[model samples]
Target: MTLHEITYTIKDIQGKGKGLFAARDIKRGECILSEAPLVYVTSNLQEALKSIFVLSKKNAKYFYALCNVHHDISFEFGIMKTNSFPLGQGSTDAAIFRVSSRINHSCDPNVHQSWNPKTKKGHVHASKNIKKGDEILKNYIPILQIQEDRKRLLQENFKFDCRCSACTKPSSERDLIITKVNICTGLVKESAESDPATAIQYVREVLGLLDKIGGICKTSYYYDGYQISAMCSDYSLAQEWANLLLESYQIDE
Candidate 1:
């Protein structure tokens, strides 16, 4: 059986410290990395610290090798704070991986990261065609947040200022798009129960806005459209939305 060759490598990035980079040209939607965590724990400080104690000597060495940007905290906790990724949406727990944690942040990122419950691993996929040697970045915060809010959150949590393409450019245009998406998202929620058709319309609006900025999270919106249509007894449109939702999901898979 042929094995898949690794497509990424860890490299030292100027100003950004260490970063994940493409080792070869990678197509959009390609799975770049799928890795199980070295440590997984609830976000509670004591629980997380205790979890680290059970790490084997080799694994403990690997964990400590990862970066710790928060100098004020104890070394172990600071490393956890800096490198852990949330297990899933709304998850109270997180996982720490060796190479995946080396990925740096960009507001306009080229990769998407998700937790796979079935496989119990974290997956990273290329969201855009990445040239060999290009750094693979992922958005560390919600993509829809405006520039000021993103900056504030990044600085407060991650202790760094992002100068990514999205942040370095004039943010007025992107901020306007973000505002439109937020407005449409609110309308979708508000209208879903009383006006299913209108909710679908707002979902489409959200999808379009996302497409304008690389279609970061369209699966959820497509599912929203499908659910609302089905609830309203619009079988035809519901099926269309369902197919779209599946296709969007499979791309990430």
Candidate 2:
């Protein structure tokens, strides 16, 4: 997707400063935006700073406009630390895209950022149906994490207090969500090999929990559900789940 096709706009989000906001109501599974990075750098900060200075004039201008969350650091390195996301499976490579960087973090985000190595570009997909005025949030940490760990990571790295519903929930309520997430994940791992049938049931539970917990992009779960269904030779169920997974990706295969 290009800038022209993007359905969101950058606007001032209260308490979060600048953020990507949905310009119109967005359907679940819709591609929000996709773009090639302005620059790619090694994990080394010194090299990353050197790399940024050498970017094309236009790219450098755009990069400089991005928010720098770290105030007490070098401006160039600060932006890199503030906005860079991994470009591959390893931490050694990173990429920065103008629009993607503006997306704010939420403990319960409405979007999922995914990297497509084949195209060498990254794309954000709506995790749940988003309203026109809603901010297009991206979770900066793992979704399965408990509230304390999530907030601690954000505080240490981004230097902000997360006030999202999931983060602010009382321990009694928060623990339930954490417990359910762990149960679903553990069930999938344990049953996946020994009991594929049970794995399918566990995957269903996972998808349901994900939807309840604001979707955390649940796309991965649907894919696993499809695979498990196929493994059970339940072609009909496999096709159904495959269709849902495709809808979640909004990809034309």
Candidate 3:
């Protein structure tokens, strides 16, 4: 789909100091857009150079087409670097586009993007009830870190400190949530190296911490948020945690 055809409109995010998409209306699980890359470049330096050389000749028509089609070359290149989605089995080449790259990150984002290699397109979807004027967001980095880490990354990459729910929370409550997140991270690490018997102990510890923090600890980005739910075969809990994650985000089972 062309940029203007998409249902969302770009708007200035409060405190984020960047443009973000906002739903024009309450969109269901509808496909907002499916976009193909104007340019596909590999991550490996040598491979990328080689692909560029090859495309310069083999796909020269398309290459010239992109150069003419896109107005801001530098911005397009930056977006490709920042938001290019991976494609090809065992291949490092990434697909870059305009609309998807405009999406800013959030710890609690309302939209998600999915890449489909067969179709050669990335699908953007609403993950929650995005209000008409709510700035549509997708977490750029994995939101599994504590508040400090999350804030640091946002400031460094996006040039603004996050005002997301977790970042703007009261100091006392934020600290407690961080403590629980730390505990859960430790338990997950321990579980990774422990025997089945010891794994259960770690899992129980994580669940206990989750219970203690209540809603504050229940945000989707926590590292071990779905571990207990997955461990106990609690599909309901697992689904809840899955829904919390941004659409394109993945967790090992």
Give the TM-scores of the predictions, in the order they appear: 0.93, 0.85, 0.58
Of candidate 2, the 10-residue stretch with the lowest lDDT total is 244-253
Order the numbered candidates by lDDT, best leading: 1, 2, 3
- How does model 2 fare in lDDT? 0.79
> What order do you get sorting by TM-score, best first?
1, 2, 3
Q: List ranges where model 3 is wrong by over 4 Å.
A: 1-6, 11-20, 27-29, 45-79, 85-93, 185-253
CA-lDDT, candidates in order: 0.86, 0.79, 0.56
- State which candidate, 2 or 3, has the greater TM-score: 2
Positional deviation of residue 171's Cα in model 1 after best superposition, in angstroms: 0.8
Q: Write down the worst ten-residue block by lDDT for model 3.
A: 62-71
**How many pairs of residues collide in each model?**
0, 0, 0
- Per-residue lDDT of model 1, residues 192-241, tens digit only: 99999889889988988988876776778888999999999999999999
| Per-residue alpha-carbon lDDT of candidate 2 for residues 189-239, written as tens digits (9 for 90 to 100) | 788767988898888787776766765646677888888878878899899
